[model samples]
Target chain A: MTAKQNTQNSLPQTIFRRKLPKLLLSLFRSVFLLGVGFVMLYPVLFMTSESFKTVSDTFDPTVIWIPSSFQLYNFKMAFDLMNYGQALINTVTILIPSVILQVASCLFISYGFARFKVRGINFFFGLLIFSIIVPVQSYMIPLYVNLQSMHLLNTSWQFYLQALLGTGIRSGLYIFILRQFFKNLPKELEEAAYIDGCNPFFTFLYVTMPNVKPAILTITVFSVVWYYNDYVLSGMLLNDHFPLSVTLTGVSTALNNQLQNMAGQTLGADIKLLSDAILAAACLIVVLPLISLYLVVQRYFTEGVERTGIVG
Target chain B: MAASTEQKTKNKPKRLRSLEKQQRSWGWLFLSPWLVGITLFFVLPMFQSVLYSFSKILITDNGFELESVGFKNYLYFFTESTTFGPYLTETIWQIIPSVLMILAFSTVIALVLKSNFFGRSLARAVFFFPVIIASGVVITILKDQVMMSGSSVSDMSPSYLFQAPDLVNTFSQLGIPDQLLSSITTILNQIFDLTWKSGVQILLLLAAVNNIPGSFYEVADMEGATAWEKFWKITFPTISPTMLVVITYTIIDSFTDYGNLIMQMLQDYYRNNNYAYSATIGVIYFVCILLVIGLVNLICRKFIFYASE
Candidate 1:
């Protein structure tokens, strides 16, 4: 009987020991991830919920997470006050041309750096890396003055010039990414193309460019998002015609003024409340396109980031 | 016919040399845009900024006039300025802890996200959401709203989750010094902000973790390695390069962040028509960033493992 008891106890102990730690670890992971996910997502949820809160509901302490009444009017007010349509158009006009110019120029520059043994290439590449380290703010004052003298300020030509010259917003990072991608490509394709009587340019166009599509797509998306999100450059350069980002900055004051005119009573404290709601709504609108784009191309986005080896 | 073919073969080397020269010229042709950009935008502007920093810029009828101040602005900034000292120190203090927290948080979160779990993709999307929406305008608005609501409802709010004064008090009671307590609370209070800024870092770290060869883990497992042992031996070394990159990226990102006290000060100066002084401050800040980056690179390089190609 004692021997039987010992066998039974040992069997149960082995079974429990084999499965318990794995189960506990998975449970711990889930709980930890859930907690972090909540933290990461709470702000967005707050923004969305706050955007739907009416001016009165915004200040009510009990009204948390869910609005007492769905205030769809906040979106309309924000849209009109921020001039969403015009700002969106202005942003796109600047963004599309600049994105194209930046991507094309950076691709050419990176390909040259990657494939060629040009003299002083290392020196130039070192300077390129240094430029990446130097924040735009460091040179903004001088750039502003330079642009003003060139009559380039307050015009889309400023962006076009920078993009054409491979110095647009975050262009250094893009070039770095592309160069790394190109350097890693196998030499066999270019060799084959050359043997087939293809010139270097044609070989790059046919054999090399197609292979780096994911990187190209990556740069395109990143450039577009960065340009779209840029407020400092747009604010400094284009004073009269505002992009979506710049417009969003002053949307609060604009909404405040609009609310006062409509309500006609001194909305001194209430203005803050109303404007906060409108600001939330406007913030959502500005970021809507980017979020949707990320969702659609999530796979490519992750893959592109992986390929660039920026982390590595 | 044999002699003619030999002559053709003899010409091939010369032809190839010319082709190489042509390729070199084409390379420069392709790189011309960048070259021009560097000269016009980067190099010229940087020199002009330095000159502006050392001069008193005056707006003239025709154009701006620069009267050389012989380092007066720099002198004033270093010795006489009341605002610069506080702003600089505050920014430095903020950067150090925030960078550390972001690195640790991102690495841990990346590891967790890398594991095979249900709803992993959704969790990743949730984590990456901030990279999409945490724009300057959005963050400013969010902060204001949180502060406004936080003052009213001290508890039972998400903003309160970040406000851990009680935790700080408890730590203080446990013999933690006042200075350390305040710093701890400051970090705690800005936990949300730090987490928001960590979106890209997390993505980068996650990619780095995923790139680690599974064979390393399999071998470790076959040798009866503990999870902790495997992490240190296999995961850490493989991802050290990425850690350096993330750390550098984080430092730069944090320094140049738009929503910061120093940026606000610079903006104030710019708005107040202190162009020369603003340039001086900007240059100084840039130098500080360079020093910090150099320091980090120096320290991290010692531990960085480069797999031999």
Candidate 2:
């Protein structure tokens, strides 16, 4: 009896020892990631659900997560009140030119830093990184005043000037990323191009630039998204024709005044009551385009990140 | 040693010297646009800002005039301002927990995402969701809702969802310690704040983890090392450089975040047309950032491991 019991117990005990911790760890990872993912997801879900709520549903505490009735009223109000179309056009104009110039200039500059070790290059590189860490707010006064003097404020020229020079919105960081990628590349390829009677410029254009196409795409996507979301500099410069971001920022306060004197409606009470829901709808309209863009390009996004020298 | 180096340089071959000269010119040619940008937009502005910080300026017809104020703007911020000291300390305090939590969460999430699992692509995209909402209108609205505190709207927003862990009320019934409860509340407060900022950090870390050579993991597997043990021995050391990068990125993000008090104050002063004081504030704020980053690098230098070159 003792021998039989020992054999049975040892078999199960060994299986348990081998499997339990591994199983637990896998379970823990899934649960932990899902929990955090849910939190990351909650705002989107909350806003969507809230945007669909009737004016009365907001007042009722029972109406959480899911609303009593689905309504397009908030969205209609948001679209008309926010002047969505004009703001989007303004955003696109600056965004396209900025992203194009930002990518092109940064590409050239980073390649130079990576390929050529000129006199004072290290000092320049240090300054580049220093600029990255320094808050733009510190330098904004002088830059802003100078730009104003140039009559660049409230014009697309301001955006173009910064981008053309490779100083547009976090361009320092972009230069750094591209430089890292360039440094890790094999020296033989550029040398071979040179040996084949290609000058350094042609070598960069043909041999080197093609090699970093994925990185260029990465920079382009980042530039687009950052330009789309930018508020600070754009707000400062484009005071007359506001972008989507600047418009959205002051939407709440603007809504309060606008709805009060709105055409043919006494939404004074209802607007106050439904302000949060309307804001939610407006947020979605602004955010949805970028979300769709992400869904389309995230594969290249991750792939590009993998190829960069952001790693050990 | 210096004389020997000078002799060696003097005796260098003609072809190599010509190549060096060619490279010097080419490098400058490639970097010309950026060099101009730095000189005009960066270095010049920086110098002017320093000068502005030291004096009073009156806007006029001919590009304004500066009058020497003898550190009055600097003195006000340093000695007289009541909020300055607290704001400075709070900014530094904010970085510690925010950076640690961001680093910890991003590392764990990136690890989990790296593994093959059900709906792994979806999970990866979901992890990057915050990066989409990081800077713009949506985050501002969300942050505003939280800042509104105690309103019904605030309670219903995502902050409430994040604050679902009302363990204080639940545990109070069982008579748990008050101090632990407050700490728990503090962590719950930071959850929404820290977690959203982890998106870019996660992206960088995932790349770092991917760049780790497969052979190390395979060797660890063959040796029967558990996942946790393998992570510490193989993964952590390998990813230390990226960890430093992530930490620096996180600290910088926090310092420049929309909610930062110093930033708010600086903007406030700028908006109020107090240019000199604002410039002074900007300079001081920049110094604080420099000191913090310098400190972080010094600390990281001791422990940051680099794979054999």
Candidate 3:
């Protein structure tokens, strides 16, 4: 049909007008994506390269992508300095419970919102959105004081309390995401369960819970990332037994601590020179777990987000 | 529910009330945790903070004391505190264009990501890499490294590897108003930051686009719609609702961002233990955010095309 119409016109003109821009547009898109992707990945690649760079490599202008020599010692130094094992342990101790509790509580809360639109639920939903925002800095001091009074300031209990109660970091946003999933679910499934004389609680457990596994996995990944990446609260609250995030900001101090333990004093001179690579190594070590987790769950996470129909 | 509580009063209305009670009770069972959590973690703290904002907070060894000062703390930002006012204005100004640019960038990227292309997964993996490092502490650590490496952030921007701008520089070199120049230059310098921040928004818009019904596009094709026309007619309307979600999310995300200037201002006040002033700053920021979100929601909702069941 286009050939008949295009018989009157020159074929090259049709191709140029119709096909050229389309080809150019696609070409532009691919280049844009690849270019932006490279930009996005540059820091990671830069850090990776920097983590292995030696003293000589830093001064070498040509050594952008790779170093002249690989320095594995930076990893060892960063690991020791960061107190990696202890920090990881502390992080996990806080992380596991927060992820589990936040997911469970948010799952329930979101289900409730999705299932039943009672009077004033909108108000509470508004409040949930408010809580997602409303900068934590505003009320952080009072919260600190409260935790201090309860003798939970330095303990993991503070994290637990918030997570268990569905008020942890970004919990409201999780609730919002999960609610979209629950809301989109067919009502017939629940009605069928109810017709079978299944009670609401049991139906929630047996019927609704299993269907939202993708969302649970997504939020689980999110909660883990958030809690693992959390330093502000942990830094303010904990006086000792700092998590990976806390140690991250103090990699230099960790280096000092490592040296002090071994040599009875920090070798302050040349500390900056040595720290560049060590800092890069520490960043890699810190984010390695999260990156792997995201990689493993990314396919499912994307699918889950799509299925939730993230509409208005 | 099978056995109505009031045996004496056997009526449909009574039974309906009981069912309503059952539904309400079950719903609240699931919702009560949120209620309790909000009360303890949010309402109380938020109330106390607002009160603290309106008063003078004395950090006594035993506990803090609040001396009511009316609107003095609120007044401090405009009338006295220099950083808070300027920083807040800067942040508000930055957020408007930042949000629009992010939305447009994300929408395009999301379209590309969801569409079939060679090495798409690799591209996605690379694009989403920022989500791993985009958290406040990690990104700050990276930025600190960049700073410590004896290169200014703009000179050694992550984008500098691929993007060497001549036009941007030429445009900026051409005299513009200070406010517009500052904003544009700042944006030019922050291309990497802005692009990096698009990771989450891209994921969100990708989800929304993926959620679009295939039938809409098929129908558009049957009607001989061009790609651009189909996008504007089908994809645009279908995804308009999610645009609201993205808008709200981006606004909150940008405001609550770890490296935010206003947050830093609040931090400085906080480090000095000036709780009242910080509270005022937080409140003002909070109100500003609410206003922005509300206004955007109102505007976007009017255009939203909700697909009926």
CAPRI band for model 1 = acceptable
Each model's TM-score? 0.86, 0.89, 0.87
lDDT by residue (B160-253, candidate 3, tens digit) is: 5423366456765786666876666667777788898887777667766877767778888898998899888888887776677678888899
iRMS, model 3 (angstroms): 3.2
| Chain A TM-scores, candidates in order | 0.84, 0.86, 0.82
Which interface RMSD values do the candidates have, in the order shown? 3.7, 2.9, 3.2
Query: Relative to the unseen true structure, what is the C-alpha lDDT of residue B258 in candidate 2, on a scale of 0 to 100?
Result: 62
Best by TM-score: 2
* Candidate 1 vs candidate 2, TM-score winner: 2
Taking all chains together, the TM-score of candidate 2 against the true structure is: 0.89
Worst 10 residues of 1 chain B by lDDT: B145-154
- Model 3, A207-281: lDDT tens digits are 988877656766787688889898888999899999998999998666655555555353344445457677888
Candidate with more favorable, higher lDDT: 1 or 3: 1
Best by lDDT: 2
Query: What digit string (tens of lDDT, one per residue) describes model 1 on residues B191-262?
Result: 888888898778767766776667788889999999999989988887776687678778878877877787
